[model samples]
Target chain A: DVKVTQSSRYLVKRTGEKVFLECVQDMDHENMFWYRQDPGLGLRLIYFSYDVKMKEKGDIPEGYSVSREKKERFSLILESASTNQTSMYLCATDPGDSRYEQYFGPGTRLTVT
Target chain B: AQSVTQPDIHITVSEGASLELRCNYSYGATPYLFWYVQSPGQGLQLLLKYFSGDTLVQGIKGFEAEFKRSQSSFNLRKPSVHWSDAAEYFCAVRGYQKVTFGTGTKLQVIP
Candidate 1:
């Protein structure tokens, strides 16, 4: 069984604050992803890391960045959190060999006030 | 670009009734398809996935999905519904390095 753990389940931050969401996977998957889920928008990718120190921007990467200093950990950073950035953030990991089924974390519901 | 569409936004079914959720995709070739379930305030769980082999695939929780090449649809089905089956279902299509998810369908199981 693969386990993906997120640092926080819920968080609250003021506007213009810097926020960090951490994710760790025990499976040592090669690909890690960060996504924000909205009611009508589904899961939109914010950023993804294929390897250590390698990152790519997903569809919506505007105020967000990612860090993958190690193979087992991936972190998502919000440079300047805004009210619009409040969302349910999910972290997922996928082994490159698997058929693209990603294991997800419990998600962090961030509230930017 | 790859995309997935879930037509139904909300569905209501009684316990022991049949269940079906519609999903469609747009891509050049046969892409990886997946169905996920998310409980309230929880993360998404993989129910089933269709990679390459057979058109019909079985997943966890007595759920199954069939891939139709002609229709470009991968619809999920269950023989009988349970109260615990109430959740949000998302259909996803995965390309080489990208995965596109649907808006999801909320299922309500009536007593």
Candidate 2:
């Protein structure tokens, strides 16, 4: 079975602190994505990478950035954490083929105090 | 631009009852449609998707959705609801290089 692992299941950070959320997929997929899930807004894409070292901004890219150093690993970076930025973050990957289904990680819950 | 709408914000049903969740889309042409479920503090899981060919698509966990072009709706249905099926459901439409998800509908399972 394909597994997408998130480094941290729960995290708490102070305001103005830098934070990193790591995601690794064992499926050898080519596409990776980062999204922030909120109560009423649902899952809003923050960024996505189709290949290593190539990233694209998504609908809610503001105040967030991502890095894909290796094909299996993707990282989401919060330059300065704030209370408003606290939310459940999700990682996903899509195989490079006609199967457009995206597999998701367990998710990281971040709380900024 | 392609967009998705889940009109129902919340719905409650007793266990073993029938279920239906509505989804609407706005697109110039036929677009890729999808339904996903998210449990509390978990990532969204793909329930089903409609690309082409058949209008009615069966998905995991005994869930199915039918695409209606005339009404611009893709409604999810299940013959019997389970308590474990209570979760937030989202509808999405894939556009150029990205996909937009609806706000989501929260399901409550009553005894």
- Cα lDDT listed for each candidate: 0.95, 0.90
Q: Please provide, for model 1 over B1-111, each residue's C-alpha lDDT reduced to its tens digit, 9 standing for 90 to 100.
A: 899999999999999999999999998977899999999989999999998999999999999999999999999999999999999999999988878899999999999
TM-score of each: 0.98, 0.96
| Winner by lDDT | 1
i-RMSD of model 2 (Å, 1 decimal):
1.8
DockQ of 2: 0.64
lDDT of 2 at B51: 85
In order, the B-chain TM-scores come to 0.98, 0.97
Interface C-alpha RMSD after superposing true interface residues, each candidate, one decimal = 1.1, 1.8
CA RMSD of all predictions: 0.8, 1.3
- Whole-structure CA lDDT of model 1: 0.95
Tens-place lDDT digits, model 1, residues A8-105: 99999999999999999999899999999999889999999889999999999999989999999999999999999999999999997548699999
For each candidate, report its DockQ versus the true two-chain complex: 0.77, 0.64
Worst 10 residues of 2 chain A by lDDT: A94-103
